[model samples]
Target chain A: MFPGPSAKCARLGHFLFLRSLTTEATCAVTRTPTLPVKQATRPQKSDKTSISTAIVLNRAPILTRSSTPFETAYYSYQARIRRALHNPFPYDFYFKQGTLIETRFNLEERKRERLAFGPAFLSKEDVSEEKRAADIAAVEQLAQQEGEGEVLMPRTHPSDTSGDVRSLDRKGQRNLYLLLHVLENGKETWRFPLGKVEKGQFLHQAAQKDLYAECGDEMDTWVVGKAPIGVYKPRQTSAEAQQASEIVFLFKAHIMAGQVKPQGDHIEDFAWLTKEEIKMRVHSHYWDGIKDILSDH
Target chain B: MSMQVASQAARHSLTRFQRAPKITRKLRRHPKTGLPTPHVKIVTREFAPSRLEEHYHTTLKDDLMYMTYKHEIGERPPPRQIRMTFDPEDPYSKYRHNAPVGGSQFHKKPAPSSSPDNVVRLEKIQLHTMVKEAVANKSQLLSAIMQMKALTGETFQGGGHHAVEGIQIVRAKKSVGGWIRPNVPVGVKVDLKGQAMYDFLGTLVEFVLPRLRDFNGIILPPQSSSIKTPSSVSGVVSFGLPPSALVFFPQIEVNVDAYPKLAGMHIHFVTNAIGVGAQDRARALVSGFQIPFLRR
Candidate 1:
């Protein structure tokens, strides 16, 4: 289903996915010689010269996918929401561990699509003019530098979980932030990896620290989107007291690169998954957090 | 919208998948124990590991006979075939793989009567002894440690023996977190030296854990040697001693271990009782093998 007439409405619905480039090169690239071409820069992050007797990767660069506006919007909301939930303000009571959200804001949802591209979405509750501009500047700069990629792993809302989010939000507008990232055919679900955030650590820092700690350090992340801030209490009277009352900043990261290496004594292995898949595999609240990241952004 | 934020989160699914154990058919049993439990496994595999190359075959494949010592400690059931085994000739076939020599050995074949009586050559490692898990965990962890040191924030001395977090781990961060934890046990080694079974065992006793850890529900007191025994640190541990005194004592060592806490384990220890009291203790240890509480 696609919108009609209006330029913005012309190819509105994201239902029709033309993923591959196998068709005759009708000059999508060839015709638009003037269109911006952002090369996937291999960030020559660090030199292994000292470590290797003969460094094979002299220019070994870490290839990062170009950022998308959808992803920027998602993360923007996530950081803000997480910040709000963790502050000394009394609003912490509202933030939940599993903030169920529907796929109410995918690229196809007409209202969502409209709001997604709006300056308002990024500007919401973002009071500090300077900080907001800095954030937007990063998004715009990344957008100009965005590389080419197919929307490969597109997930649709499942029937069972479709109405669950709508039922959870008190606003009755449907908290569409619990959907998980997955392959188009529904392969992997975006589930939170097993990790712990030490005290006095930033939520995002915790995400990175825990990742390196539990999952191998090779875990690459593509910030797909962000969601509303969630106040995730591990569990009342649980042993992980430090985690018992803390905010969770959830973002949809694509395991776009690297291997799922096992590192920690507590971990067995690591995986990249979508929400529906998590429903059948992982029996944990981490799945709910992943769902929020996919949907909220 | 911050690239700094999203950039860090984006890891390739391919990278994670590639690092995952080459998944074949999902295993029904555990990678460690054949028990159908998740803690015992993360990899879904049919066999424990291909690395477990210790297989024992006799002229009669089904006549699985292990070293009387291994059976004593219950590293595995007195050798049995992959499946139930019984001679075709026996009515209703009531024997198992380790059952005495029957009319037919490997099934459909006549019982092997020509081979030497004790000619049980190592055929294939059906199930692993403790040493096997070390082999599996070490090699796998070795590669991971290397990759970890290669991470941006991770710190390490490459091939050196400096510590990582708090433990004496050799490697540090490579990436962020994901799904599936390696069910295989990982112990920090001083070098790859601890990767070896004997060395790993030394670290476990001398460092990671102390004696009198626990057996079943009881806190086992470490056995002090009235006289020195001919066993290593692991051998001393096998005696169900306290975690404090894991040093070798003058006794047949017991081989009991757990990750850190003790709820269940295989009890390996020395028994001087021979002849008259042999059958009695053998029966008792056999029963102890099943009920950890009794042995504790």
Candidate 2:
């Protein structure tokens, strides 16, 4: 049962302005001075109101998106325009004459020129074939020594190829949300990690505690703000409806390092899913409630 | 045999004609100016993908919207009238600039109600440096100007954009009794926008900041510092980099000896955020770019 009006007022005063108040406390305080109009309107419902906090743990993109073919073409065209209009490079300021580095730069510049224009656009050099060949060889040797041709890490992770949903590394260029498959009312359901808000708890604080209680302390996570980003109201059965109407306040959090370790028996499994994947797993009504909150990309 | 010899002679003449080099048309010089006339105005745009720009669109934009969102039940009421305004209709002040009664209390103005379109974003970065020696002799400003040009690689109207004032010489506006004279150049600055801004930010974070010795982070003001200030409302986060740190810039590092003197610079990150506590929001956006901030 809800606390008495006098007790609630004292608790409210103690917590005021230090942390943001819960919806019930906020409504009560706003109306307490005038009249207990909210309590009078819903006498029985006020005592059985149920509130829970959910955490939307997120992983931001790791890699920059690859440009589409059209984008690539546009960039190249712009680059060509830039090259043609660029001012002359001050070679004397940056490079010494007859230095190997300068020689390498000159060779690279000619190659880029050929790519921008064509081989036919370049004037024929006065140097003999052997000298030109020697310069090329020297530059190649320098490049080899400097490890310039080392391969970069591939954009796609191994987990992506294997279709491992649990691995956080699966999607390198998409926002991934953490969703849990939990046993609710003897039925398995996919939802954000949810836990009941204890008495006198701030919603934001409850969100953090709930996340750790379900997801374990292995990961370092930061709740985004004091306010909840969104809310979800679950459909109630006749029996449950008679007991309490449930409300879930969803808070966004970022997982900086480590993976979620589902601690309790209530949480059956967990997956790092993109927005579309989440839609496929969660109920239609639930999706309708939270779809707008999830990022598209 | 006579016919064959005639045919061979004709073929040889045709081959010689084909081998001859043709003369190309030259660009005509303008009659008034003596400069070669080109048919078109050339403008160069973004030539490559901007990583930081993409990161903002993909990640930071969404996170910022969530973090800075203030939930409201209904449309915000019109702001309260703080002071009376001078009537323009008054005969004495009709032509004069009628200032507000309490001056423009811009610093105290409330932030615009949160909405999708008004999310804060960086507008541009301004790099400014003052050359002390330039006050003695104007020629000393050349080194600072050169340094700005080198650091940003911006030339006057370089990309054919008229608004792009690549690097500018800052001249004194008023004469101080003995230290300075009006119209004398004492400093240089460059404004970076678009791809150039992101590129500069990336270079600063990746190369310059990490290498600075004994640097913790851009320090924050004391906890009780007043938020109601012109700078706090203007949404500009300004900081200074010492002259010794100038060499850490990869561009300057390449030819450090070329510069006669290095001057410390003030960098201002100007964002689109406005109103009370705007600097806090701007700081949030900047910190998203991994420029760390430390509290005293």
Quick one: best lDDT, which candidate?
Answer: 2
Q: For residues A6-37, what per-residue lDDT tens digits would candidate 2 score against the true structure?
A: 24333533443233235446656656657666
Q: Each candidate's DockQ score against the native complex? A: 0.01, 0.26
lDDT of 2 at A74: 70
Question: Which candidate number would show the highest DockQ if scored against the true structure?
Answer: 2
Residue A164 CA displacement from its true place in model 2, Å:
1.2
Residue B54 Cα positional deviation in candidate 1, in Å, after optimal superposition? 54
Where does model 1 exceed 4 Å of error?
A1-191, A222-229, A238-248, A284-290, A295-297, B1-296
Worst 10 residues of 1 chain B by lDDT: B50-59
Query: Candidate 1, A218: how far from true, in Å?
Result: 2.7
lDDT tens digits, residues B1-296, model 2? Answer: 99999976654343222232444667678899897765668788888899999889887887788777765667788876655366777888788877778888877888887888888898999999989898998898888887888889998988899999999999899988989888988999999999999999999999999999877888999988998989898889989999999999989998899989899999999999999889999999999999989998
The whole-model C-alpha lDDT of candidate 1 against the native structure comes to 0.30
TM-score of chain B of each: 0.17, 0.87
DockQ of 2: 0.26
